[model samples]
Target chain A: MIKNFIVLLFLFGLGMIFSALLLGYTPDSELNLTGRYYAEHTAQDLGAANIVTAIIVTYRGLDTLGEVTVLFLTAAIVGMLLSTGAGKGKSLQRKLSQSGELLTTGSHLLVPLILLLGAYVFINGHLTPGGGFQGGAIIASAILLILLTDPLYRFSHQLISIVESISGLIFLALGVLGIFFAGGFLDNRILPVGELGSLFSAGAIPIIYSLVGLKVGAEFSSMLVNFSETEDS
Target chain B: MVTIAMLTGFILILMGLYGALTNHNILRMIVSFSVANTGVNIVLVAVGYIHGRTAPILNEAVPAAEAAARIIDPVPQALVLTAIVIGLGITTLMLAYAYKLYEMKGSLDISKFSELKW
Candidate 1:
């Protein structure tokens, strides 16, 4: 009972500390210097209507690259750990999972539409709030739906791996292209900024976002496949 | 409103931390840690919020010239976006580790794996 009381007291202390911090925090009534600068410059400088996208893809492109690499490494580590235990050459093997006809047909119909929507999301990323990560997750969720509905359905390891590698390579090549053509590595100023808010504007942002979307999708699908094909499960 | 969001985030973090500290099952601990992660993301985004402001996008709703005065911080949002992805990576890695532990010992209770306990 004393121990329980101590835990409660500790928790209450923690909650009070957090509440104090929350109270002390002043929500900005005005745009601060960094915020103001990014807001003013993003559209004119990057030719991207979506300031967030400009900030994410061009201003902080290196961080995004590192983020993608971290995901890639995670996927690789998961695949390695699972592959050794789940047995060799069986990662891509199909299970005997059967589904209702409605689910099967619905998945077949929905898959292409989901892929299209994913493409649309990344393509319009420079003009909209959605971007590569969101679109990639959507596409991966579509794959997940199929995996759930049809457990026997086998995703081609070769195709997914090829897509993943190519996209990463393209992203790196685009960054290198930045060094030769623009301000620095990952710079989006290589091509003409073009008309603002247009589909073809934002230089390599949309293209880079599309590649990121594909790579993220493939990596997620690879991880899901690894989880599904485990030996003990 | 921003304060409310921040408060909610802090509450979530506290709850998640409590659950993680008390949970004996490895899976539950992972779930709790993920909850804590989500709380952190919400707090990060909340910290960047401003009063009477729109998103940092330059569209018809928010004109380009007026954006400096009307938009919230984009840097925090960008940082949070990357943090969210990295959080997922770490969670998945922990899950894989949990799975390996379960497979090795045929137990999910973290207490049972206290081989290094002094």
Candidate 2:
């Protein structure tokens, strides 16, 4: 009872401290500087209504590219860790086959639609609230659905690895092109900005977002596969 | 209205904290972590909300200048989306590790799985 009382007192004190910190906080003016300018200029200059996408893929495209690399590295590490033990592969396959047909058919019906939606989100990211990350997650969800419905459905390791590597290379090539032809790395002005709110506008933002979407989708799918397969083993 | 959302978010966070603190199972702890993360995400989205505004987008109906004047910030939405994905990835990884540990030790209780201590 004494110990419990002490713990409760400690928690109360911690809560009080956190509340004070929250109450004392003020929004930094400096943080608003870029956000304000970005909001003002994104539509006029980049022709993208989604200021976040403009910031991510145009103003800070390099950072987004780097972020993709971080995801890639994480997938690699997780895959390596999960694949270390693999004795019951055949049994796992059998268990997967027996899971039922409803899941399989439902996932089949949904996967294509999810993929299409993901593509749409990334494609229209410059014009809408959605972007590469949102689109990529949606795409990943499709893959996860497949993994869940069809346990026997094994992703071709070679194909996923090849896709991931090729996307990474393409991402690098685009960045290098930006450095060579544009203002700096990932500058979207390499091609004309076209017109505001047009699909063809934002130069390389859409292309880069599409690439990121693919990479993230593939990586996340592979990670899910790795985790599920490990469980079966 | 915003204050209500903030209060709800805080309540969820507190509940998650209580669960995490009290739970004996590793899986429960992880689930509490997820709840806390979601609560934080809700707070973030709520903070970006403005009255009588829609998402930041330019359509033929709304001119670019007028659209900018009325749109709520999209940065937090994008950031939160990224955060959600990252959180999902981390959660999956944690669950995977937990499963592996369970397989090896035949237990999910946190108190019994302290083998790495020096």
Candidate 3:
């Protein structure tokens, strides 16, 4: 009872602080300096229709790269921590109950469509609301669906690693190329910023985003595979 | 609108914190933490909302020239996106650690693990 009281007291204090913040807050009628600058320059400077995408993929590209690196580290750590048991490379002998017919059939029909939508989302990151991270997550959901349908199914670790490595390498290489040809590292001006809304517009934004999507998707799939493959250790 | 979203986010944060503090099970704690993480992300996106602006996307509806005046802040949206992804990574890490703990102790109770305590 005393512990509950203490917790409630703490929460009450926190709530007070939050309410204070809420009471003092007012929605801005005009864009602030940074927001104004991004809004004004994102299109003319980067040729990306989505200002958020431009900011993430180009203006703050290095930060996004760091974020991806953090995700890579997380995946690597999870794999290392989980894979160090007696169930490393052994074939699956444990029997899993069959998933329902509805799920099996639904996954078969949806997996291809999901994969296509993921690809389309990342490819159109510069022109749409979706981007590399979201698309990559969608792709991972497809892998998850397959795993759910067939728990014993195995994905090629080699293929996933290769896709991850190549895309990461190409993403870094393009950033370096920006230094040589454009204003700075990861600048999207290496290729001509084509027609603003065209498929090939936004210079290298679409390519970089696509690579990011592939790398992220591969990383997430690898993690899911590792998690599913864990045996009763 | 912004006030409402911000209020909801705050309430969620408080509720999550209460759950996390009171929960004894490791899985419940993890779930509470995730709820708090979502609340934080919501608050961030709310902070960027302008009174009468569209999203920070330039299109036929929102021409580039008037973007500065028309769009809400994009920085917070981008930051929230990063936060959500990082939050997922952290949640996955926590689950993996929890699994390892379960394997070691065969229990999911928070009070059972005392090696690092004290």
Candidate 4:
């Protein structure tokens, strides 16, 4: 009872702090300096319709690289942590009952469409609200559905690793190319910025983002597969 | 409207923190942490909201020339995107750790593992 009281007391104090912040907060009527700069310059500088994409994929590309690396590390660690003592005595495993026909058929029908949508989202990252991370998550959800339908199914870890590696390498290579061919690292001006709002505009952003999408998708799929493979152990 | 969102976010953070503090189950704790993570993300995005502004996308409706006056901040949105991904990574790591703990002790109760307890 005393422990619970202490916890509640601490929470009450934290809530008081939060309420103070809330009461003092006021919505900005004008864009701040950094926001003003990006808003004013993104289209003209990067030819990207989506300012957030331009900021993430170009202006702050190195940070994004670090973010992807962190995600990779997380997936790798999860795989390493869970793979030990897994899949032993496969012959002794109990057979899982077959998934319902409706689920099987639905997953079959939805997987391809979901994959296509993920591709579309990342491909249009420079023009739309969605981007590499969102698209990659969407693709991972498709893989999850497949696993759901067939619990015993095993995805090709080799294929997933290969996709992840190649996309990461290409993403880095494109960033390097930006230094030689464009103004700076990860600059989207390697190719012509093109007319704004066009599919091929934003120079290297769409390509880089697409590569990021594939890499993230592959990494997430690898983690999911590693997780599912542990079910037998 | 922005105030409402921020208020909801703050409330969620408090609720999540309270749940995390009180929960004795590892799984429940992980779930509470996720709730708090989401609340943090919401507060972050809400901080970037501007009065009477559209998204930071430029098109015919929001012309490039007039973007500064028309759009909300994009930086916070980008930061929130990163935050969400990192949050997912952390949640996954916690779940994996919880699973390993469960495997070790065959229990999900936090108090059962007392090796680190003083």
Q: In order, what DockQ does each candidate have?
A: 0.76, 0.38, 0.89, 0.91
Question: After superposition, which runs of candidate 1 have C-alpha atoms over 4 Å from their true positions?
Answer: A1-10, A88-97, A231-233
Angstrom error at residue A230, model 2: 1.4
Better candidate number, 2 or 3, judged by TM-score:
3
Q: Which ten residues in a row have the lowest lDDT in candidate 1 chain A?
A: A88-97
- Share of native C-alpha contacts between chains A and B (below 8 angstroms) recovered by candidate 4: 0.90
- How accurate locally, in lDDT, is each candidate? 0.87, 0.75, 0.93, 0.92
In lDDT terms, how accurate is model 1? 0.87
Tens digits of lDDT, candidate 3, A1-233 = 99999999999999999999999998889889999999888888889999999999999999999999999999999989988874655648777779999999999999999999999999999999999999999999999999999987989989999999999999999999999999999999999998777889999999999999999999899999988988552
Per-residue CA lDDT of model 1 for B5-87, tens digit only, reads: 88888988988888887778999999999999999899999989888888877778888888888788888898888998899
Q: Candidate 2, residues B2-23: lDDT per residue as tens digits?
A: 5567556666776677677777
Model 4 steric clash pairs: none
User: Which candidate achieves the best lDDT against the true structure?
Assistant: 3
lDDT of 3 at A231: 55
Regarding lDDT, does 1 or 3 come out ahead? 3
Better of 2 and 4 by lDDT: 4
When sorted by TM-score, best at the front, the candidate numbers are 4, 3, 1, 2
Off by over 4 Å in 2: A1-11, A17-31, A93-101, B116-118
Give the per-residue lDDT of model 4 (tens digit) for A1-233. 99999999998998999989999988889999999999989988999999999999999999999999999999999999998866654723768888999999999999999999999999999999989999999999999999999877878889999999999999999999999999988988999999999999989899999999999999889889877877843
Report the error of model 4 at residue A136, Å.
0.3
What's the TM-score of each model vs. the native? 0.95, 0.88, 0.98, 0.98
